[model samples]
Target: MRSKARTQILFFLAASAGVTMFGMYHVLEALGYIAPPRPFGDSIGTVAFGVDIALGVLALALLPSAIHHDPMEVEYGYVGPPSALVACLVILSVWMVSVLAAPAGAIVLISLSARLSLYWTVPAVCASLMSALVYQLTHSPADPNISWSTVLGSVVLTLVLIAMGSVRGLVLRRQAERAKQAKQARQAQSPQQTQSAG
Candidate 1:
């Protein structure tokens, strides 16, 4: 159990680091700190970008599995509103710092809400709203008009990613349930067989 916990913590840390690096890279690029690829290096740049995106997606997808509680440890009940509220606050705080931190905030919320409950939707919605709010606040008035499409896209993407995490949680929950039922059936059969033999 100790070894398993250590492995989970390590996996969570690694995924978090990868996600942070991926988010920061794009933030820097958006701020013009990282130049676009030159004509000669375009293909190379595209490949690198694709790899980064793949890593980011993989990290997000694995996050629920990495942090999921053991079936025996999980309490079978709905998580209350307070838990959802705290998750929303955490995501809001992260987004307040920078809209570019949306991915990081999503990760935090997803990890928090990835369980067999409806609580995931609360933080998911909050994160999406915060993304749009931060974008509006950060956009300069003098800059070209705010692109509503960009805001909408961000909101949609945030919801989609978090929904994916929720789905993962649901799948894990179902598998655990099936395993528990099978174990119970085996135990029942064993007792009956012993009685018949005696």
Candidate 2:
């Protein structure tokens, strides 16, 4: 598959995972096994969450267009570092607000043509902290004797899944890059061959 399609597929899968995690956390919380997480700031905080959701939705909408159009095709202010910064901030804000809604959005931004220079390692670290914070802040164990094994296991499992996804995504990206280079090479050769034949 083309890189664009692969990216879309990965985003969809990641989004599903995020939503599932959010749902599971809520269910577990209701069952008294986990603590209840709160919204942003109470009443106004909900607006921030709304913004987060909106940004995610926007990213989803933009990914398809990114496939066909060069993200840098625009004039001044339309592409570059500023845009990348905005994209990252929007994604990070989404994660800050709702854990389950950030994946697809983040992936969308990453796949864009903005050419963000930020390394993925930093965000990976942030993700680790985000998950841990959510778990700790929302703990609601009825028994004080409960061990942290379950939490640790869940975290480890999540990391493993993320690693697998990242590897898969990287493979897809490399294939796409190679394909692009091959096509360019062929185009370059075709004109020379035509001239020589003429």
Candidate 3:
């Protein structure tokens, strides 16, 4: 697949994930105690989605370049310092700001996007937490113990996200490599020779 197409696929995936998150939020809302994680208009949801989609796109764009070439090869990939790393930090910062500053409608925009990193981070944390929960469950008595079902479900979800990230990363890398190879071939072509005999 082309790098651009791979990026588009990832961008689409992130949007779909956002939709899934929204559904979960609604289900929780129906329970009466759950408010929007980041309420739109009043919260950071708008900016969140924007940031998320932006980051995913940016990463997708840059990530492909990085796969086949070194920092020197990928113009976007910086060698001296980790720009993607820094962007992750910025993503988190802006997300917090969006969550605090935006109104309810705008909240959804950046709120979800802001958590883009969490697709990688949150699941790691959640999976670890789930493991601990499971361990505790084993030791506790059946009557007053934590919910095994909930722990197991959360663990399964977390693992799935981790697997998804791995797949996405691999796909992006492969696409990037192919793009790099094609560019190299095009660059390798020598200019046409001109001979004049008088």
List the candidates' TM-scores in order: 0.58, 0.45, 0.36
Tens-digit lDDT string for candidate 3 (136-198): 443233335676676566555445544554565455557667988898877665332222221
lDDT measured at residue 105 in model 2 versus the true structure, 0 to 100? 41
Candidate 1 Cα misplacement greater than 4 A, ranges: 1-76, 80-88, 92-103, 139-145
lDDT (10s digit) by residue, model 2, range 1-198: 235666567767766876676567556756879644343234543453354456446644443443233444233233333444444444543453455655654454344322322354345435544544553444322333433565476456445545554565466557656877898999999999999999
Cα shift from native, residue 170, model 2 (Å)? 2.7
> What C-alpha lDDT, on a 0 to 100 scale, does residue 176 get in candidate 1?
67
Q: Which candidate is the best by lDDT?
A: 1
Minimal lDDT window, size 10, model 2: 109-118
lDDT of each: 0.55, 0.49, 0.40
Comparing candidate 1 with candidate 2, which one achieves the higher lDDT?
1
lDDT per residue (tens digit) for residues 1-198 in model 1:
115776466556655665676677767866789754333255655664674565345444544343444434344674434543454454444442342333545655555556545555665566567656654554332344566777787677666766776776677668767988999999999999999999
On the 0 to 100 scale, the lDDT of residue 96 in model 1 is 26
Instruction: lDDT for model 3, please.
Output: 0.40
Candidate 3 has a TM-score of: 0.36
**What is the Cα-based TM-score of model 1?**
0.58
Q: Given candidate 3, what's the lDDT at residue 95?
A: 24
